[model samples]
Target: MNAVSAALDDKAIATGPAGPLLGDADFQYLRAFVLEHCGIALGDHKHQLVQGRLLRRLRALGLSSFTGYCELLRRDPHSELGELASAISTNVTSFFREMHHYDLLVDELLPRWLHEKRREGDRLRIWSAGCSTGEEPYALAMVLAEAIEQSGSKVDARILATDLSPQALETARRGEYSLERLAGISAERCRRWMLRGEGEYEGLACVHPRLRELVTIEPLNLLHPWPMSGPFDAIFCRNVVIYFDQPTKQRLFRRYAELLPVGGYLFLGHSESLHGVNDQFELIGRTVHRKIAE
Candidate 1:
């Protein structure tokens, strides 16, 4: 099975008779609700996976039946939307998960932007559009911090990390991770950027204050209205649109294009492509696109 299928199937065991079973009508309502609110298209086969995942949520909310859960959504979808999306959607991410994207920033983009921005006094903004538990943005901040110091440029730069999952955003805000989670980071970066915990907090690592200062974490549902005005130099929306339907992808990419200037970059997941979805961005590198002048 594919990785996504495997992830969705993880721990998706059939509930016992003691627990409430997800009925067909309620399942359909959930499918539709998730699609409209979160932009994730749930296939018919995902019913059991959804049921298994949401069972935890049901228990948390003191709900005994799927009907009760659906009623909660009906009463106020926004109240439960983040928790619902967190249950259904996968947020598997890591520090420097896709290293090449960071390499591109370090080798080419950052230097050029710092140089140009130093001359023009323009601010640099990179949005980590689905930042998950903060690893990605912190990773970006490491490279960005290194670039600024090396270039000796006083270019105002920052990374905006946003995600829809309340739980994930809470972890991101905390910025602490188990030592094992540091595997993806290089040894030098780990030494330089990670503060090792002690005594009761042993085996945990916290990000340096510089990374926190560079990244602004916020809660954002990509399908909903965005509060920030833009002309962002680049956007890292990796592994996010894979769940979106065609129309949703089209709308999201169009919105992204509107916020990016001509020649601005859009970095996507390794498995995702803009082909036959959006024509405003030209393929510039592996899983990278640049906005084209109209």
Candidate 2:
């Protein structure tokens, strides 16, 4: 038995009714399944993490064991796959989590992109790949809106926000959040771009219709074939690649390179790096890359 399975087997046998235990075999099966379907490589050490995350699903479905859950996935792979992905993956995000990327977007990228679009009369497109719960795309919209207002440019721009989690995408489509989620946004921006909830909806805020109009949220699994064609000016795929294995990261980065033109920007998570993975992009800022070659 693998380490994770061995560790959990005894606990699972002992802990009856407290929760359904994730067995060794089940963990291995799930590890491989998640890697194959979502490009997320769960390590042996993550067995406990997986068990904890999936426990709620077990209860929700009235499942008695992890094996039963696995069987359910096997029985209906198409419908249940998304639920498995939602349960296993992490979706921790906040508005303007990485502030500097937006700063760079407003200061450098938008101006150049807008200028080019103006000359060609083409609309601007940005891909917020792995956008979770709307923060990243909304953040992009806010910055782009501010840039357009300041420059007095009649630039038509849109953000295509995608995520593997359908639940997260639902929340993103709603474009509503509790007041706590609106922290760190400036008062002027809050007033201009967000609707302050009142009365029964106190302590809630929603993205203004104008801002929401600039973004389109969709369900997309990065591991699967992408349908939309893109030569996006910039792509924000931050904090996402860290979950994948090395080869998966390499392939994903190469795909991102293919989607961007020379000088197009690609933003990554602060902790992620392109070093030794793909050299098509050059380091332009902290955790930001500019596609330098084909």
Candidate 3:
């Protein structure tokens, strides 16, 4: 289950004094809307949980009840879709959350890619599909910047960090984090890449401009159509697909395959897999799949 779902599960399954109750019709409508627009499946037992979580959204929008929210959705689904997704989902991520993935890039992939791409003078792209805040892309940038600097190669390289939540994307754009959030990073890397703040911002650290330069943050809903067309070298979509149902997962992996060239890589969350979803990629490492010629 996703963080929001887990949070709801942790609760007593009671609405309590949380604004208004979510009626059956409105709850069903929300389930369908979420399933269609967000690709997340809401179970029958999730009624009370959805009610409890969405109360905050209702309060924010000055909505009196679930029926009003449903009506607003009916009038204009696009306007509030991202906010709805934000309310119902949780962004549980941290710097180098999965160290093994980084180890693979730093140890083997980056050197080889830099060498080959330098020879070919080709642009290298990596997409962080659900970059919650800035951590994933910035962490990626650290290694990527190190690789480029070490190889002395200026192969046009960039990391695309996209998330559906506006709030999350804004945090990513800021590229600043609390010092406590830097625990996942090593002390040497912290000294090298993070700029510590003083005075009013004493507890915070901002990403170096080089890391910010290498990362481009954008807002993108995966269920919606995409604007870019390209062969990315690798895609990190970790911990984002646990909410998606079977068909959604199938279509998403297929689209990822379309954007990745032969031998490109797809890095999934440790708990996620493409075993029955798609056959375009072969598993090469823990939760890492490489695209194969069909």
Q: Point to the candidate with the largest TM-score.
A: 1
Ranking by TM-score: 1, 3, 2
Per residue, candidate 2 scores C-alpha lDDT tens digits across 30-57 of 9988888878899889999999999888
RMSD of 1: 6.6
lDDT of 3 by residue, 35-69 (tens): 99999999999898888888888777766667777
lDDT of 1 by residue, 76-116 (tens): 89999999999998899999988889999999999999988
Candidate 2, residue 95: lDDT: 88
Task: State residue 38's C-alpha deviation in candidate 2, in Å.
Answer: 1.0
Instruction: Provide the TM-score for each candidate, comma-separated.
Output: 0.94, 0.92, 0.93
Better of 2 and 3 by TM-score: 3
- lDDT score of model 3? 0.90
Model 1 scores a C-alpha lDDT of 0.91
Best by lDDT: 1
